[model samples]
Target: MARDNKAMISGFRCLCAFIFVISACSIASFLYSCQCTSPCHDPGREWGQSLTPNQTIDLLSFPEAWNNLNFPQVPPPWRMKIAVFVKKWPHRSQAGGLERHALTLHLELAKRGHEIHIFTTSPINASSFPKYPFPNLHFHLSKPTAAGYLDQSTVWDQFQAQNSSGSPRRPFDVVHTESVGLMHTRSRKLTNLAVSWHGIAYETIHSDIIQELLRSPEEPQAYSLTERAVKVVEEVKFFRSYAHHVATSDHVGDVLKRVYMIPEERVHVILNGVDEEIFRSDFKAGKNFRRNFGIPKSKTLVLGIAGRLVKDKGHPLMFEALKQMIRENAKFRETAIVLVAGDGPWGSRYRGLGSNNVLVLGPLEQAQLARFYNAIDIFINPTLRAQGLDHTLLEAMLCGKPVLATRLASITGSVIVNGNVGYTFPPTLELLKRALYRVWSDGRGVLEKKGEVARQRGLQFFSATKMAAAYERLFLCISSMSGGDTENQCQFEDSSR
Candidate 1:
């Protein structure tokens, strides 16, 4: 009996040792994945992971590299006290158009000597994302919901208290609210108020209807009639309020003027921009990029698409079009492959489409994304519902990849002139297929030439520097009209320190 007990104890010890080893290995693998190190050393490995510590430091220190967006030289910089209110800010794992726009614009502004106070729910964890030193920039972090949405009450309470009597802090020169953060507040009593509108509630409802219509026979409806109506009313009511509005694209500006009945003068049309230094044609494209994403290198034509895998993003249309092509066109079926980046609720259904060639690479970091863009021959944006301008399209264009996007949106047509940067198709499987086939048959030379044009156009118009400068000019215009400070100079303060 004593010998039996000893044997059992020995077995338990061995099992515990095995478990410890497995856990250690898992932890190491995760750390390695998140580590910022050079993985692909070859210049030809454009999609290779080459994030060295030195490169990161250089990216941070070099103003020219960071602000590659071209702008006319200004006299001495004007410093303004700017309050930027955002519901969400980008982090390592999560980001969208709104976050990217806010970050890019604010960073450039900070570089230009403006003091910025960011009131946001999405604060980067210090362990995960090291906070870069920006002397004039301060973060007012607030607690958010489990799903990452901000608790607006915190922001409102802070603002009210700061504005209330007996407060030591001075009032902000200008307040720039993003999305519906300003809508939640009762007081538009601030000296100068501006909103960076990405999309209003009506566009969301419109997208839902399109998605439901595209659903399969057995698929359940995504929204109810009552919900749609309520959202429209809420959105219209929000937009109807008067303030200086920053529209991300020409299409969005029209929506503000026509749908919301905002005065034409109040609407500021500033197109969102890309960081040309990070996303450029200099990166060499090769099989390594494909291997990084588990994509086959030998495919004749590689197509890439990135965004949330949601109903409105037109993933359903893309899947259906690919299925039809596979059934009807033999050449496309054999030679073409689609590489998908990003993850969402509809991801499983997308994978269920079951084309062996369609590879879905879940969300990737910016560096990883640049590589992915280089690996692909063509970038596809089949977004049916107009959601202002998509940053991915600009990023792809900056990387010298031609985009085939839908013509429905106001921005896509403006950016992608047919036969110039890329071809735009109507939101239909037949139209999309034809465009795809046309590009495939036109061969690599046609795609490369169009991509070169795209790079030039992107640099000329959509640099982050240009977008930031436009916002600064708008701020000055609004400030001057308000009779506040005609000089439009920023006052730097190190409040966060």
Candidate 2:
């Protein structure tokens, strides 16, 4: 029995040795090769991981590259304190009309010396060191979102926390709101908060293309039927509700009243102004510019288009109209040159059509755009897609160019002079072509007459400085006013089905 016990003990010792060797080997392998929670194939880093391979990686914490719009111009000083809430401050979609208008408002307000704080997304393309220093103007980067739609919960929590934290901040005097999502939609009391409305949000949300465009992503967007139903509910429940709104035009104001049922008292009509200084240049056809851009300086009847490549800003109608103009109008054969400028999804398709007369010269940076503005004697904005007025039309008029915009842009109130400062037409190509021919007539005499009328009309009403002054009064009144009629505001939103 003693000998048997000794044998069992020896066997136990061998088993122990084997276990020790296995544990040590495991430790050595772990030290050499890291175990990653994430797999190698994940494209957007949905999960974090570690690897044995020594690699450098760069990531975008914010998805949108929005720093292209610079709010650098320092405003001198003005009395009213104003806070404007936009999705992104230095956003690049300046061609999107609203973004450009927002920048123009910011600069004009800052120049006037009004205390302005712009709450926006993280700016992407600013100086590495930091500049655009001004006491009057301030820009705050809102919290970024990892998830969209449902991500608003996190955004709200962060905003509420920040507001409560009170870091390097004073109470906001007035808040001018725009767009969907974030502050614009958040129905907080935010005392003395003034909402800025371009028009009824419902008008835009119901468009067929916009509905389809939202789902046209490469990845599965989780955009099922239930999600869309929830979105519609949320829009109705939250977005349509506002304390007050400043509509940029009377037509839009009427829509707010008739369509959205917003009260007249709650809706204020404030026209957007064009900056004559920036749009109107000596524009003396810089040397070789007319030739380099493929045009004759003297006799060539140049028609310029400068806006987004979106189907909404009326590009399709304009293209079709140009086609009609060239095909039918004999006079266009000698003098007509269609210069379409700007960039978008439809850009390649526009270029691919390869109409010899229609030169899709890609997009022009603002400076380059100014030269093109000078190059053309006539301007066309066939914006059938969106409802708001075209700032480009204002720019064109300031450049002493005749414009042919749709009747929808009747909001500008500057498109016609006894039906003369250019002309108005429906989105139909027939109307657009007929109007274009009437204004330019493939002749210098008619172009000069129409151009002069356009410039005069622009000077009469579209000056940016004047608009800034209007906003100053608005800011002061809104900030100083207490006990706003919230009941009326709610009643209007509810009734405007």
Residue 491 lDDT in candidate 1: 24
lDDT of 1: 0.68
Give the winner by TM-score: 1
* Residue lDDT tens for model 1, 209-236: 5666667789876535445545555665
- What are the per-residue Cα lDDT tens digits for candidate 2 across 6-57? 9999867755654554455347435523542342212233112332233321
| Predicted candidate 2, C-alpha RMSD | 22.1
Q: What local lDDT score does residue 376 receive in model 1, on the 0 to 100 scale?
A: 88
TM-score of each: 0.76, 0.68
Clashing pairs in 2: 75-110, 75-111, 77-113, 78-113, 78-114, 260-496, 261-496, 312-385, 314-382
- lDDT for 351 (candidate 2): 66
TM-score of 1: 0.76
